[model samples]
Target chain A: MIEPFTVLSSRTVVLPVDNIDTDQIIPARFLTTTQRDGLGRHLFADWRRDAANRPREDFVLNRPGAEGARILVAGRNFGCGSSREHAPWALLDYGFRAVISTEIADIFRSNALRNGLLPVVIDADSHAWLLAHPGAEIGIDLRDCTVRMAAGREAGFEVEPFARHCLLNGIDPLGWLLSQVPAIQAYEDRAACRA
Target chain B: MTAPRTLFRKVWDRHVVVPETAATPAVLYIDLHLVHEVTSPQAFAALRERGLKVRRPDRTLATVDHSVPTAEASWASGLGEMDHAARYQVRTLGENCGRSGVRLFGVNSARRGIVHVIGPEQGATQPGMTIVCGDSHTTTHGAFGALAFGIGTTEVGHVLATQCLLQRLPRTLLVELEGRLGPGVTAKDVILGVIGRIGVDGGTGHVIEFRGEAVSAMSMEERMTLCNMAIEAGARAGMVAPDETTFEYLAGRPMAPQGEAWERAVVEWRELNSDPGAEYDRSVTIDVGALEPQVTWGTDPGMVMPVSGRIPAPAGAGHRKALDYMGLSAGAAIAGQPVQVVFIGSCTNSRLSDLRAAAAVLRGRRVAPGVRAMIVPGSQQVRAAAEAEGLDRVFRDAGAEWHQSGCSLCIAMNGDRAAAGQYVVSTSNRNFEGRQGQGARTLLASPLTAAASAITGKVADPRPLLEEGRRIA
Candidate 1:
């Protein structure tokens, strides 16, 4: 059963830097296995490893209150490099329901929506505000494309109408097409000529 | 009122078949189907499970890339290192393609490279065609005016079963690239610059037709690099009109037609260009010469600036929030900043040309004392070609670690990665926060720029290094 889009639990996880690729999201070493399981444990393979190759407790994800955090308040260009769906799969599997960023890589954005991960794009200033105030919970209303803070501050965003429709219904592009009977029927009628 | 139609819609509308009702699937005729090593295993297994042959094998092409080792020594050990299960899956893909009579560019084939690379080089990526592969970068084929997108394993099975799948056409966005590309700036920078201008989600719901002199002048490889990253900007797909450069690149390839047939193919291809005065739902133009060798300052590709520029201050709501989260101050110059690591490889830029370009910078120079650098080839073929020219030696001599290719450090799905809080200069695409490793700082740059940065132990412009190379021009 598809899950309808709803307000996601949003909060900023501050990293304070740039150019983060998938390697950091889920390290390359974990890719050797076919199983997608256990990836959540090794999300930041190299960085999380200690001098003796143990998990580093200082990592944001390893720190207090960050475990299983739903909303990822991240830096610009949220997903870049490699068209791996696994990056989103890892993020989703790790319990992030939404990613708020200033920008994203083209492929990562597509994969995100298809996998049911909502990527919200906010302006730079808003991103900074959220970053500076960690644990500041935010709410994203998909129907309105608005992200609001608990403090009553709100920002309107723009999402493709089609994407918005799909998100609200928890349907992908193909799934959305499946919902439009008339258009599909028209297409079928036209396609009957080729048959 | 009738809206102006886009190429994607026209092509999509022409192929969609009606289902039993609106909720039923609209069967779409797929013109080209590309397959690679990682995702085809299960698709083949399902066919065998059903005792079904691949439908429309003529439209299907397969290749081995990921998991194929780059060097002979590595190839042997890597193959040996693969668990029995992984080996079985790879062999199954090859055997199934063979039994189904699908053209398979296997490990030993000279034509084998990245699945995306093989398509356009061989003219299999035709205009007005809908191409799909299980790999997400399949969008790379769109550069030749095709409507290409990636599918999952289940969708792969559907395409194999019907030679058609369900899809709706995307709206069109015209992205015009004007002016000239500056020296040392390549197609990678062009796409990066686009993502930077539009932000990542700007092209959602649209198929982008890239135009203007800058796009027209790019080689098919360069064009593929551009279109490949379109998905990064949230575009459904990205394409360029077929032109002489397209035809020339297709000529003489193994799968491409010869002589008169080729001429006929070109005649048809020439007509694939968008009509004059075609309307786009949205259009944006970029001046190319104004672009410098770009580098990602924040995690996203659009969080980028000229190599000489500083990290942009968070201005808009999103940028500010992202910067605050990233713990970076606004307007910090990225140049001359120390880096602990550097990487060069990915579907985005790890081709022979990118390696050669990086080598030109690293040939005689050594990486900074403490900085670690890694060079990974995009495919086995690229590795072979690089080794043939002794590029590997050049990389090693400069204190760079060259690894067996399989989406290394690019995604950290393999053993390569950076420590937390470590700063890196990488040639791979995307710089999303925590992309290289959680809490690690990623600075995205061209391969040459990455190499130069490695030598200087800081983010540095590649132009000076290129100027020092007498043969670069």
Candidate 2:
């Protein structure tokens, strides 16, 4: 089971670009390993590295005071494109606990929730505030379903109840499904009998 | 059962193993689970970690794409020119599939190809089925009246362990095309035109049901080309009602039922359409009769314009960023933009029909002096069919590389890529920045458009070239 996600308080790393797709999060070339660990090193590899594989100093993650930022404030349509879970795995491995965006792609939102990495969709005004004040302190509370900024401005967000329950209780989706083996087998057996 | 219901309601209702409650989602049984090397390794590893065996290995089908090279010798060589990591990933899938008891269309198998292509080709994708994979384009199967969509690896693991998925109900959007397509327009152009009308996130939280005269008139492969880009429109999936054409495509295939069962299946499939006056949550209508050939002049699929039109002024931040990344300015004609690379493959349009159309354009012509082009068959079956029809000879004689069946240059995970700062006219979906390669600018277009661009070395219209069809032979 992944770590239980409930309340998270931290400074944020801002990337003010729309449609930041999974390809930009982790390039296809770095997706070879079967293991999920160590992917944090390659998160945003193309944007973080130069032609010679040296770290680009101008990148948001590589700059000073960017280390250990546990939240990401990104633009709209964050995590679009491929359904690669490597995108969220890399994000969580890179020390992000939550992502604040104006919009998030469907499959990516599901993937992030399963991994206990929160995907928070806020209003445009709140998102603009986060974009303007880079490194702003913010708090996310699953109990209240709201995000609180440093300046007392806040916005309510939506999350599926079951996904929220699993994240709230450190419950894994596969584990829950495994517990329903009898029901699944019965369904199949009935279909087989019909055939 | 007599109440009016949408097509989505029909398929989704039949697959519910356990209904949703206030707290949990419906546990839907999947009829087919298509797997690939890129997304399934971790899923198998997770099963091993949990000491779990595959609940229904019979329903799962795996393949080696996204990581395997497409060189002439690569299939037989096993390791071929693949780097250490690529070779490792391919081998891992083999080991995983072997230990899990799932059937794998390995690198050397004649049935191997892009996951989407081989499924329909083998008849594993059929009417009234609920299909899924770890790739976003799994919506391609919805052409056969199936309720299909992509899932992430975590859900992949869940399905592997139980042969089921937990999902909330998605809203239905009826996208109706009023009339038949124009001469030069194709399934790709129709999809592009729709995505351009609705922004990328317009279909978010909904599954699109395509209905009308144009959809009814298209072939099964053409319907697949239209549905394949549903994800680009941020749709959960895209669907079309099954008809006689769908049954004809599935008949006599190895995986399809024979004799009495086939007749019974057709009867049931006939009832899979939306009833008269069934309501959808939302609706949109487009007139395909007057549409022009479409092309993406920016970074995303929604930033598209007709081939005969000029790029429009940016309306917001997203369009501005797209134009900046594409190195284009407003009011410039999308035509005459030079391209260095041309790719004509992917799940969107790599069928035999697509190959024949491209070959028809390049029949007695040659690729431009500086343009590098490649035509990757969607599957081994497609490659063999093209070879038997002499289409491969046409492509090679016209100076395009006739690559083997694999996802080459589309995802670029197999060491096939356009160089930095190069312009590429591609038939694949998703022209996101760095999707083809780092700093590569991709213009998404129909296979016919891509073929014409390869000949002219610039973005060009395909209608005139296609109208010049009778001159050959």
lDDT of 2 by residue, B31-131 (tens): 89999988888898888888999888899999987887886666557555787888888888889889989999998799999999999999999999999
DockQ of candidate 1 relative to the true structure: 0.17
All models, RMSD in angstroms: 6.3, 1.4
Q: Each candidate's TM vs. the true structure?
A: 0.74, 0.98
Looking at model 1, residue B6 earns an lDDT score of 60
Residues A73-106 of candidate 1: C-alpha lDDT, one tens digit per residue:
7776566555555577678788887888887655
Summarize candidate 1's per-residue lDDT along B1-473 as a digit string, tens digits: 44555666666655665432334335677778998766666566656666766767888998866555443355666556554654655576788788889998776676776677667656677767889987767778888778898776546766776667755445788999998888888898899899889866677667888999899888877888899888777777888888888777778876777888777777876767666566888999888978898888765777888888878767666577556545567778878888999988877778788898899989888999999988887766677789999999999999888866655565553335677788888876667655566566777788878988999998899888888786655
Sliding window of 10 residues with minimal summed lDDT for model 1 chain B:
B17-26
Model 1 CA deviation exceeding 4 Å by range: A1-195, B1-5, B18-26, B40-53, B67-73, B76-112, B315-330, B363-373, B384-405, B419-421, B437-440, B471-473
- Taken in order, the candidates have interface RMSDs of 6.2, 1.0
